[model samples]
Target: MEWHNSLAFAQDQDINDEFAAFREEFLFPQNNGKDVIYLCGNSLGLQPKAVVEEITKQLSSWQQLGVEGWFNGSDPWLQYHRKLAAPIANIVGAKDSEVTVMSSLTVNLHLLLVSFYKPAKKKYKILMEGGAFPSDQYAIESQVRFHGFDPEDAIIEVFPPEGEYTLRTEDIVAAIEANADDLALVLFSGINYYTGQFFDIETITQAAHERGIPAGFDLAHAVGNVNLKLHDWNVDFACWCSYKYMNSGPGGISGIFVHEQHHRDSTLNRFAGWWGYKLNERFKMTQGFVPEAGAEGWQVSTSPILLMASLHASLQLFERAGSVAKLRQKADRLTAYLEYLINGINKDLGTEQYKIITPAQQSARGSQLSIICKSNGKKIFDKLLDQGVIGDWREPDVIRLAPVPLYNTFTDVYHAAEIMKEAASATA
Candidate 1:
């Protein structure tokens, strides 16, 4: 689609957008009493208006029923998490039983590693992307150490060829094959947080399976932002945080997806707790651990009702929006418009003042574009922030801007680009 660098064009596009009304559902941060351009959904999404009502209902339940709230309330606290399975499964493309909301992301990652990262004497190494989120790096390093393997010898990172900003699919597959003999597991992010590059999960999983290695994903940036088919893709396991593109509040519940194939495998180990005990016999106070079938078996503690309430509110909106496919449709166009407008700035200035390091192809990226400022990057970023255009700045020079389909409008992208253009000229 051809993109125009004009405010009227973007406003006209907004007029025709079917999802335009969805933006009203969120409470955007304000600047000078008006909503600021919130392009930072890649970090934390705007709050849903329904979160307050849902949370209040739960608070009232506690007030009226006290301890009895576990069984007596209209929405029983005992089975609160059961309601989340279907909606979350839909978002991540898994069966209802294959998905469950649990602890925070990193915590869940460590728990999942217990089951999936089984290293034999010969096959003892893990392969991953070079610049994975720091939390994942630390988790893998510690897990390797726990197994008596040095991190340097047990962890293999596949990096892009020099002068490149992203990894090619072929390179990733080759790395998996090269380390096939020693690889106990292959783990990767569904999308790189820093570059917004969405990896090809299906191909990567197939490659690992051929090498007799289990493949897992950290979908923190991919679950709600891109199309996923974790079940059909035959991925061994995956986990995601709800706060980013899912519009759940900060530190909201994290979710996990364990393939049905792993559900009945008793050989796997879990750091079991009472919550994962068989649901029907949970109150029996049994002496031994018997996990509930499917992903729910991974739960280690009682549900956090307040956090689940916030997540449920957001999932309802996602359901109303039909599917993640619908969100991606609008997201692609909105993000493209931002890219087009930025390129227009460079053309007008008669120089390549802004270089977009993110993949130009839609299939390889989501809504974010990581731009490298040729000069005065931080000063320009600050100027945009002072003007209330809220995209996030990374260290040194890059600015990560995301056009979230659920809450951001085409006009918001237009205004942000306008402010950015002014910043470019002013700083120059």
Candidate 2:
């Protein structure tokens, strides 16, 4: 699809976009009393207009029912999480029973590690990408120490080759094989947060399984942004947060996917709570920890209905928008337009002033473009914000702009690029 760097072309595209109306369903931040072009969905998505009604419904239930809200409300707090399973399962490409809404991302990571990271005598190491989100690094480090292994020895990090910004799929598979003798588990993020490079989960998972190691992923960046088939990929486990591309509110609920093959594995350990007990037998309060079947069994506490409510609102939109497959159709074009416009900016300047580090292939990335500024990176980013073009700034030099399919329009992309060009010129 050839893209033109003109406002008329962008407006014409928006006129034909079937997903254009979704932009009105979200509330955006204002600058000078007008909606800012919000390209920060990679950080936190714009709130859905339906969120108010969803939360109010739950608040009303709590006000009227008190302790009885658990079982008596219209959408019972007791089974609220069950409503989320089907929708989220659809987003991550898992069966309904294979997924469950639960704790935040890092917390879920720790819970899953307890079950899948079973270290044998010599096979205690975990392999992961270098420069993963700090939360993952800290969690893996502590988990290794808890098992009495030094983190420096027990954690294997696969770094990109010198001067490169992303990992090669073959290199990742090679790392899994090279460490096959000592690796107890292979864990990775579905997309790297900084570079926005989408990993090849299916290939990575297969490599680990062949070596008799379980594979897991933190899908915080990829869950709603890219196409994932966790079930077909034979991933042992995965977790994701709902606040980014899913458009749930800040610090919203996270979810987990545990393959059906792991459902009845009684040998696995869990940090259990009463909520995870067999549903019918739960009220009995009898002793031994009998977990519910499927992914729900990983629950370690009572469900937070408010958070679930927030996510339900957004998932309803996802359902209305059809599958991630459908969403990706629009996302690919929108992202490509942004990339085209940014490249045009560098071309006009006759220099590589803004360098895109994200993968050029649409199949290898999602809706984000990570641009590294040659000079005045922070000032340029600040100018974008002041002008009401809101993308996020990473430390050092990179600026991440995500033109989300659910809300952002092609015109927004055009205006943002125009502002960015102006910012670059002014800063220069």
Candidate 3:
């Protein structure tokens, strides 16, 4: 496709789009009467159009049936989570039996840690990326403390050598190999939420397993944005929220993946509850706990049907879109276009005014591009926002722009770069 630098090019691209029909699937935010260019799906995806209807259906059941909605409603609140598994499993490269829509991101991390990170006296340390999301940092710190261990001694954080904003793959593998003796777990985000670096999960998992350590992932940033093979990769456990990339709305229900090999391993402990008990025996309220044969075994309580409704609405779109493979094809091209435009800004600055801290290779990142403006970062970011170009700003200066394939257009990226160029010039 020859590049045309105008909205006409965007319109032409939209005209040829197979997923263009999905543009109507979400409600874009309005700024001063027009829709803003929302390049922040890596942070919070736009609301699916069917969410209201899906949520309303659940609301109607609750209004008409009251407590009996648990057993007698349209979608039995008791078994609502069952319907959610298959579609999400496809999106994350998981088997239906290996996936469970569950608690929030950090909460799920703690729950998964309870089961997977049972460190012995000699093997007690947990390895993680140093600049992980704060929520993950807090969760890991608390878990190490709960086990009567000092975080400073037991948590091995791998940092990029002095000046780099991203972690090196070789360094990560080295960290696992070096700690092979004391390592009980290797936990990392599938994608770094800030720097937008997608780790080599298969390589990382293989390295950890070689050291006899269980490997798990907090995929909050990677889940719907990139391809994963949690089951095939043989990752011990993983979890993610549905808000970003999954497009399930703000603070929606999350999901977890437990490798099939661990499904019946009773030695793998979890915080079990009645919902996780065998579906047939659940109403029996038996004294002894008999968990369901797969990922369902990790369930702890009644699911929030309303949240599942929101997620179901979004997952339906994914199924129709023929899964993440087709989605990533578009994402790769769109991100490259955004990158092309951002890289072009260097000449306009008379120097390299912005450095792309995100990985240069398409295979090593998702749709996001983290731009570090050499000077006046916040000023440039605010100016972009003021002009109705909505990209997120991380503190200490980085403007995170994501050209989501689902809703972003080529013109959106092109115009966003134009705004950024102007912002830089204004600062000059």
**Tens-place lDDT digits, model 3, residues 377-405:** 98988898899999999988898988887
lDDT (C-alpha) at residue 83 in model 3: 93
Q: Give lDDT for model 2.
A: 0.94
Candidate 1: residue 221 lDDT (0-100)? 92
In model 2, state the lDDT of residue 244: 97
Runs in model 2 deviating more than 4 A are: none
Clashes of 2: 0
Q: How does residue 134 of candidate 2 score in lDDT?
A: 95
lDDT of 2 by residue, 284-395 (tens): 9999999998999999899988888989989999999999999999999999999999999999999888999999999999999999999999999999999999999999
Give TM-scores for every candidate, taking all chains together and pairing residue i with residue i.
0.99, 0.99, 0.97
Model 2 alpha-carbon miss at residue 77, Å: 1.1
Highest-scoring model, lDDT: 2
* Clashes by residue pair, model 2: none
CA lDDT of 12 in candidate 1? 93
Lowest summed lDDT over 10 consecutive residues: which window, candidate 2?
1-10
> Please, what are the lDDT tens digits per residue for candidate 1 over residues 219-244?
99998899999999999999999999
- Pairs of residues at least 3 apart in sequence or in different chains that clash in candidate 3: none
